[model samples]
Target: MKSYKKIAVVLTTLGVIGVSGCKKILDQSPKANVTPDVLASAGGVVGGITGVYSDLRNLWGTEGFLYYTNLGVDETLAGGGASNGGVAFATYKNYTNNVSDVYNALGGVFNIAYQDINTLNGVLQYGVAAFPDAPTRTAYLAQAKFLRALYYFHLVQTFGSVPLHTTFINTATLSDSRAPVADVYNQIIKDLTEASAELQNKPGENGSPFAGHAATKASALYLLSKAYLTRGWSSAAQSGDFQSALTTAQTLISTKATYGVDLYQNYADAYAPANDATNKEDLFAIEHSTDTKYGDFTPGASGGKINGWAYFFRPNYPTVNANYPASGGSGVMTRDIANGRPFFRVRPNYDYVNNVAFADRSNDYRYWNTFQTTWIANTANITTPRGSLTVGTDTAIWMPPYDPGADKRASFKGVIFLPPSVAAATTGANASTNTFFPALKKFDDPNRPSVNDPSSRPVVLFRFSEIYLIAAEAAYKLNDLTTAANMINVLRTRAAYRTTGMPANAVANMQITPAQVTLDFILDERTRELYGESLRWWDLTRTQSLIRRVKLYNAEAAPNIQDFMTLRPIPQTEINLVTQGPPIPQNPGF
Candidate 1:
């Protein structure tokens, strides 16, 4: 409902201001009002597009979006320090259709998405006259359409059958109706198809005047492949949906060099903070920086614009002494920026951490690379119950991949946290208890201003490696096991350990044969490759595995997850605002 009011203000008062530097294209300020006549100029068009990019920060790295995409799934649980705001989503307890009953985060996404969709509509419609050059106009329009499709894709995947709005709304409108799921997918596919044709091969190609972080032809193709893949699993599925998805993904994979995107040689290198901006594996990313003007969060501001990715997945490492006392001293490993700020909104599921993704720990280096297994002492020399510990030389806390027996653990100088299974059995802690599991290392930002500050790192939304998984899944659905195995092997091979002492055939040990390809394998492979990237919920839902998977692997959500929960309830506020035409109906069973 707020979108209606916000849309009006943005269309009437939003202005065009110039900016410079690397991310200057997205650094525009909406300070002065631009009338309809002025909106036909080049500055106005670029500024409008920049506004659309700014809106992405609202969904990509924020807490609400993080919770919506990652929680209540098989891979995660609500952490010990999780706020009450996200409890309903994590536990599936008291989850109602009312926006106020659950936290406003879910509804906030709907509102923000629609607001941006409307703004993009205006940009596409009015900005046409802004560019007289053929290629320039087409590229601008392509960017807008690509973003519009992406917003709708999120809406459709989350809420299902969301109201399809293609035209700009300059005035308040009280009437809106949800379109059929098929029609919404049709529009998404159409927009992506056009965008794929018009967009540049790469972002800022050939020194062309394009936003450094703008969507490109590869981004469009990647999304288009996903659209077709998702449609293949829906009621709107056509005979060629799977084949089309496979074809499109293969095209992106085959022409990766042409699109200026490719998988990183090592999975660890792909997520290193140093490579955040220049990672070739990233097909599209939402940009954030240390500069307060361009980054989401202000330097010392409390909570306005910040990326919570660095904080949310973290465990309470600072309190490790309380749960598993350090042999040396309490201050052995205090909180630091290198260890990440532990907001503890969500933690990995025990099943996901120990038994599933990292089962092959020796052969797959991702197990060690993906998590911080050891905490080195940050304090000076101190003597305690067991031994003397020195800074940077001794281990303060060690969370081994597998449980070392009680005798083996006690022999170690520092505290040794057992595997989740052993720890749960010994301490009577459940999966949601957050008993100092290894923190996810992918989002850790050591360069943050302070231990408590949110990260300024750009969130990589889509990667070139995902295209292989998409193609593999589509291939499996189409009964092409050979292609599926081959596609998966590409990532699996890359994930193999290449350490000095590792086996020479580590990569070969990681490869799977055609007979090993299956739906479950693909899902598990996705977890191995893309966990905590905000795609698990959508992946399971697309495959109709959410209810089953949650019940099987997630103890917190098992009891309450129902078949009808796949589609989130349409926010009651939006339904209540419909004073004209027939009222919108909420999703069934909400």
Candidate 2:
């Protein structure tokens, strides 16, 4: 809950700063006929193309807006913080101070996104300048356009009609008024259409990160299938377009015959470090390596510190943290408990896999083996770090006792237990808390505390699973049931699907079914599979199901939530920064 002003300090130390707002400035003049020497070099051009990906990260990672649009709108997500340290998270409980609130103005999301737009714009301008050949240049432009489509997709989903700027921003004609949502979608269609044509089976020779290397031409087609599905949802688009999305999705699925998208043998290996030997079955995923020899850990961390924000989820929750079960040490969960309550807790850096010992020892696969007190695996057993305490390995897991009829203490119980008030002094902030809400173990790069440390784990931004789901939803919406079902089954089989029918338990809770695989199912599947990946709120908002979905998920608490709580209040900082235009009007209820 640190201030945007402080946490994500935006000045790019990488000399890439001078070219933030406008893109064309970074590229040489087209009219000059200056006969640029670098135009012909593939290596230089390739490097510049890759720089676009880095720039994309740089733009979105600031201000946590990426999380705001996705997480803030959806009530399924609740900040674990003990109290309101800031505007958005605090108001999130009441559905107030949302990112789209114009008068109150939650400009954080918009600000960072604009920077992303500019960054993409610059990358394309430079990419086109460097690769002028028909095929090669088209491919790069397609990739640029594809990435631009991705950004715009998020934009349209979040704030409705946003300004569409194709040219670089420095032109005297600085800005365009908010374009119609249909116009924006049309532009997105144009980009993806061109990209699909240029990139189908284009192979790893080109440099677009996710859909470039290892991904076949079918990858682009599959993405187009999803894009078409998005178009299918809009009444604004002409007839048969939804069917087009469906057909594209089916066609791409048929390519599985030529180049299959199999699951990694072990369901757990999907979340392993990027370059793991077992890391096959990927169509495309965000590439991250712990940058040890280089300066930082993630794409941006530097100088042995967390200058840039790294996403965190509930340390104990399995759904968050890419279904790794016991990942992340995260922001704390708060429960008002002055009167009387009783619960135990943990901190963000550490994970508490299981407080209770499991009855069966045979079934300890991913979560238990990786980060829990695994009695299941004797080899993985953790003894006392310093020994001799009631709570066993004090840092690893804590099992503070409170029998069913035992006298209640001052702690309110929620999903993950919170510590009693008596232990509040211990659970404040310093990570000394032996009792409180359990910590999320996902983002902990223990030895590499500082961003400068080269060897830190990188989180997956997008992956093959997402591709599969996107294909499923897009195809399903287009009435292509077979392809949609197959796309979904790919993900299902990884978890535990049987030949004749899925196990009874497989359909138990949070499990996917043919019946549940509607737009809602697609959204929930995404939530279950890719929780912290930053797409939840956008998915909810896109379907206009946020209010109903959030109310259902959060009926136990915050039940009186209003329907209009969906759109966020735009940030005040942005309105202040703007030199022109009416103060951006917020969505009605904010």
Candidate 3:
């Protein structure tokens, strides 16, 4: 076991939380190591305890969240939208469910959450009594509980009733079984409520642009509302849960004191690469800096760029920043719906692409955010840049052979970081080769350092916009279609204009008729509003749309998709250490 040797001082209520409270405590001290003795000093304990959040940064791995968010959502499909068809996306679609048929990626939601619980338990076990200053130490406890709540939130959504391990268990006896969904939800509710109370007005770190700092009261309430909304709709929450959800969410939103935030007219500005937090629209994000994320953390083969390497990359297609003077990426959006239920029908008929009245552009104020012109190895296909985005040009492609861990071959990291071969593919005065595919325009940052700088940028984990979507969905679920439609307009109007191929009176006429506000409509609305973010799969599960959508939307690949896949199975490998009994049964239908 690794010894976390730097704990400075115990920063809790000045009393040692008995070890009996937890099955185990971290070995804060080691022979030759300056163990985190801080458990004794209030300040040192807080600092030492902060290590509990170490897993947050791991969410952006190649096989992790950086790509999963897009797969989970309906905003964009892996293959239909890109050339490689989002090769990494198979793990995300609904058809695969929990099974050994597929190899486990870095992000096993169950394992990750359990590990986090263990981390929190360690801090709570050693630091609560061990903190030097009880008040300061208590804040850490709140923060720890808050984090635990977030982890469980992700868990229950994905797996339904995950093995809710509250106390730290020794790996030797990690035989804990699954907890009922209700039990999991109850614990989550308890944790968030307490954390919000203690951390009241204590907003997360304004210093980091990313989600590094802790969440604020708004964050907690936002979560509370989502939890209630999910439960209220679930078979378990048939009673007054919906009303309770509304009240909790409303209370948090009502507090405009710290709730109000700036919204950037230019979407491209949101992902700029100044290696700093410059966007005013950001409510909360994990701030990354060069020092905080280096080597493997950088955006290269060795240090992949999961941070900037994100969802909705405009690949070098449809010509965003046609004047970008660099190699572009692939993955384009097609104008015609690729023959599917919602994908083909929802986009405005035609003439809406350039309509200034509804929605004009998807990028920022900079002209480059729109289109980048470049000659590539395969540049002959141009039917219409309208609905047809360049194949995988808009998606963020990385340097394939760069990272041995990922073992990607011939990958293009970014427009600016191309190697001699890839860069040579782009037509420069002396360059004869052409690297194809229009790169994604959304993740573009004019301030990026030559594409390889291990720089940190602020990334939103949760934002005010999500609040609006949640409200809209919740209202729709409560049978208030009018309210849902009204709220939905708030996001749509911002994304489009009257001229954007919509009914001339689109917004004015835009109403989710009570007849039209089915679970599907709400699902589509969620997709449009929160595309490319990691909320899709969870949203699908909560709404009971996973299996249906998976079979329908992914019919083309259904032959390869396993039908029994619904919930993920406990990684037999990870759970084999359990002394509880024979291996736990896999989630039903998985």
Candidate 4:
């Protein structure tokens, strides 16, 4: 997007430099026009390194990875909600994931990650001190190292043991074996710890004119802590990883002011696009701009500025004819577009709403604030026996439990329709798309020229609130229940702020006890706070709770899920290309 002006030019430069490589970096064949010397130059290295951030944006900016990560989790489901689309991701949830589709979704993610790794290596090859100025050199190198660690962390988590590439190579190497998961964690820790020491502690662009999409000391530290926490959960994890994670998280929480990060008093304030730079809760985000006519699509073929992800979380309103015998439906559910295009790619599960959000609906504000239960009519296109529905004011559709059935179309005021019920009588074959569920409203972007146009809202990658969760989880693992409960209470108290009509101690009433400090409890807490974010799948996998949770929460994914479903299939292309050295093995049970 136009917002990050410094890196905008570098994105185009990547194409000119011909960042062309084989399936992986094994075949290092960049364009000859771009010699090593040119790349080694201070200016060239800076420009080349900017491309890596673009890759980050491309990787997380769209619905592809989000679909893979959030869909199969207990909180959300993949597939058309009251319509049809997103079947590929449904494959993952249903445990029917094959090499071709899984490869396409996650395979593409792997290639992009290495592409980023290669870019970072190219910059590191020249050495950080090579840059003209001392401060600039340190910043650049730190950013590259931070990203390298992040890429590897994602790889190791998603594919288990993966090919680890640290340095830039000028020649082709036929085979690369999967490094030990422990080895990958070591590298990640080394990179992050080093990066955090050298990076700045400045706040990112919440909405400032200055560039806001770079790594910071806090960002690196937070991720380092998270990395430690994730590694601690591994089968071959080392001793004291939980303590290490706890210490790091404690450092982050205690040093918030020094790091230029603090939890937002209001949850909605954290996501407001207009205040990206000013939002202290945001430690790092993929900054985007609405300046482009189409929106920033550099991260991938699509982005928040193009077919933005906001629409994917919508419900198929007009397509879902809840009003039978049309006492006249809200003229084809026109108002659904006001919430943005309804790709209806992802919908929250019933239990996520009823058991979690609605469990404390009186005291907790997250349920109402995070979801859209009502949708008004934006246009009038259909007619029935009743008078024509008015636009903007008439209720077009309403979600179930709130839907007021018996075909009262003329008087229907609530505007959103829910997906099919989880019960067998209604769930039937189209259960995936036929039910009524509240759509996620967190990514709302009404500025798009059309439903297909992407919103330019910056996709937040990390924030301060999650740090609390991390600390709580790490503490729970270490049996430090006091610290765990306190960390969780911070968020609970914040959420209770929305209990305006409820009791003064409603939020305080939401706090958990030491006895409630189980892994499942923490996971459920995470769901209430970070439902739509892409962390669900990783959370489920790391806890080794995929099968248990899938069976309990996700019906579509339960039957097919197995222990091996935790790690995705290694892309067949990578396997085929590696014709030498130890036969680059695919993840077990793929």
Q: Highest TM-score: which candidate?
A: 1
Measured over all alpha carbons after superposition, the RMSD of each candidate to the real structure, in angstroms, is: 3.2, 10.6, 11.8, 6.7
Which lDDT values do the candidates have, in the order given?
0.78, 0.43, 0.47, 0.67
lDDT of 2 by residue, 1-590 (tens): 01122111122111111121224223221211111233234433333334444444433323243335434433223344322312243235544533332232234446545554554455465556654456656655565677677667766766666677664443233213567878888888887777667663534343432232323455566556656666566645667776777667556655654544545655556655443322444544333344432212354333122212232322322221211113553212111111011111112111111222111112322222223221011112222212222222222223222221222211211111223322344432112232333332333333444332322333334455566776677666666667676777666555553333434554333234555467666665564455444566656665667677655443322454566655555444544444455544555665
- Model 1, runs deviating above 4 Å: 1-28, 31-35, 97-103, 300-302, 322-329, 381-384, 424-432
* TM-scores for candidates 1 onward, in order: 0.93, 0.63, 0.66, 0.86
Worst 10 residues of 3 by lDDT: 340-349
Clash count, one per candidate: 2, 40, 103, 30
- Residue 231 lDDT, candidate 3, scale 0-100: 78
Instruction: Estimate, for each residue in 1-590, the C-alpha lDDT of model 1 and write its tens digit.
Output: 33364352232111112222224443334443434544567766666666667677777887777777888898888877765656777878777635353547777777778877876787787878887777777877888899999999998988888798887776768888889999999999999999998898976775546645668899999999999999999988989999999999999998988988887778988899888767888888877776655554676432444677887888777665523442333655778888878777787787765798678887888877777878888876544456767778888777776666666655567667666566677643212247467788898888988888878887788889999999999999999999999999999999985546677888989999999998889999998898889999999999999998898888889998888989877777777878888988888898
Q: Which of 3 and 4 is the better model by lDDT?
A: 4
- Tell me the deviation in Å of residue 5 in model 1: 5.8
Candidate 4, which ten residues in sequence have the lowest lDDT sum? 1-10
lDDT of 2 at 451: 30
Task: State the TM-score for model 4.
Answer: 0.86
Report the candidate with higher lDDT, 1 versus 2: 1
TM-score of 1: 0.93
